[model samples]
Target: MTGDGWNAAVRRRLGLGRLLALGGPEDGVWITERAATSVLGAVAAALPGLAVTSLRLAPADPGAAAEPAVPPPPSALPPGPLRVSAEVVALGGRPLPELVAALREALFTAARERLGLVVSDVDVQVTALLDDLPDPPNGGPPPGPTDQPASATATAALTTPGVARLTAELGPPVQTAEGHVRVEVATAPPHHPLEVARAVRTAVGRAAPDADSVAVLITWAG
Candidate 1:
């Protein structure tokens, strides 16, 4: 199987066992893989000129079986150090190496500070480069005052404290139609999903007041 396929199989097998088990004798606490990925991916996607396509987690042991035995109890688990891999398409013009290094650092910090996951390494693959140029002068129509780059919208949403990350499957978070903007996001725990959505709406509204309507979709809030 390909690397991605193998990784997916391994993750499925790990399931909730991937949750980071907290230390101490108090009732066990766990942070789910979904939450960790959301935070890490969001941090990476928030960087200027970078857009994450997908994020994956791999076991430290390459030869580990795709299916493993049942996981141990929370107290028995060790502090895990996992590998994080991301597929991204970045905009041109900026120094690629510097941008990648920034992304790696951001992911590492987010994973460590937010989820207590010791990220052994972050592997970012630049799948494509986005054209940074504006649309050629067309006889059709001039750009409107309300027109804003999707990246800006994304940045605004990420400003919210609890927002873990934006879903990459939906392309850019900002979608414009008839001069209105729609922002989609995924938030981490401790904050209510609706509260996060409201925060995003407020941020986007401030950034793009010209928008006729600002819509926020809380795709995943855990």
Candidate 2:
């Protein structure tokens, strides 16, 4: 049998055991709940027959706020919101099974960590695989916001204690030519939107008292 065939066998053996142990569909447990365990199980099942090194979960830092910094004088970085990527690596043989397993695990981890994410499914593409010699380890670029200018008001507003945290935590500000900026603000535990809005209005007035208005866009995170 081909290496691919062996890989499939390994996955099936491991998956069968997991399937047996898991409760039926009626239990309402999500398939994702078992994702990590399934992948690790598959790895263990194939280890004795295959030479495996180690499994690692490496997530890059989210980096500092993207809005505060000025853009570079030159060079090319995509413009817009921040970009983050997650990929799986196998330090073993050319097995489609293991590749799929690792990719799924990586995707699952990303979904849990990244907020406001919508994932259709984890699509695994086997970029590389080696034989007797260990597979080459993979590396991905560090993550940060794309090239964008800091809002004149946002930069200034963040200097304060309460307003600073709210502005920073919310995603990029939505600009309007009307000279009015609308955003959702919250306080410790859970503060009413009206209170947060009042606080923001006060902060903005303090920063730029001349500003026309600071409207609260919505109650929750926008």
Candidate 3:
């Protein structure tokens, strides 16, 4: 089908399937269904005020010798003049005045037109500049009396789970510039991997209430 055909199919008034059967670019715009969804999603995001009322695509004939690039139909979309905003703030210590302002503006501009919120202002602070650094090659503190010195090979082996072991075998799946807790556990026979991952994330959230995002990765053995 031609570009006009695509427009017509997607914009059809009666049935909605026309929008789903989106055809390739007949007018050098787009043709594939995935491409159509992306285009539609972008338009929707840009215009939050407008509500998408309808969507559909055209149909294809399998018996035809050659298929034409036909768009399903023109789906009804909301007309828009949407507005959205966002801001970033750092509490407590004072951030560099200019940097704080820049961060706020950057966040606001980035989230505008996507999320429908109005941000009046943002506050930022730089509480501390830590002087602590990782230990030098041989200048670190002596091993604690209670600590056991495991062989290098043994340490490496602990990093990878054995056939009977499941759940995380390494450090925390998510690490931040801020502090975080690492957890390692074994699950029973009836546990699901997805459930374990979700649980880990929830636990981390409880442990680090001030973090920005939580991440969880699961590895299994056997």
Expressed as tens digits, the lDDT of each residue in 109-136 for candidate 1 is: 7766655555678898988888862232
Please rank every candidate by TM-score, starting with the best.
Answer: 1, 2, 3
lDDT of 2 at 21: 7
Q: Write the per-residue lDDT of candidate 3 for residues 1-222, one digit (tens) a residue.
A: 899977665553232121121111221111122223223333433421122222222232223212222211123111122122222223233344654455545434432322221223333333333333222122122112222124332222223322123222222322344443322233232343234434554555565566544433222201
List clashing residue pairs in candidate 1: none
Worst 10 residues of 3 by lDDT: 21-30
Clash number for each model: 0, 0, 29
* Candidate scoring better on lDDT of 1 and 3: 1
- Misplaced by over 4 Å in model 2 are 1-89, 131-152, 155-176, 179-222
TM-score of 2: 0.29
Model 1, backbone clash pairs (residues 3+ apart or across chains), number: 0
Question: Using TM-score as the measure, which candidate wins?
Answer: 1
Look at candidate 2 and tell me the lDDT of residue 43.
36
Off by over 4 Å in 3: 1-174, 178-187
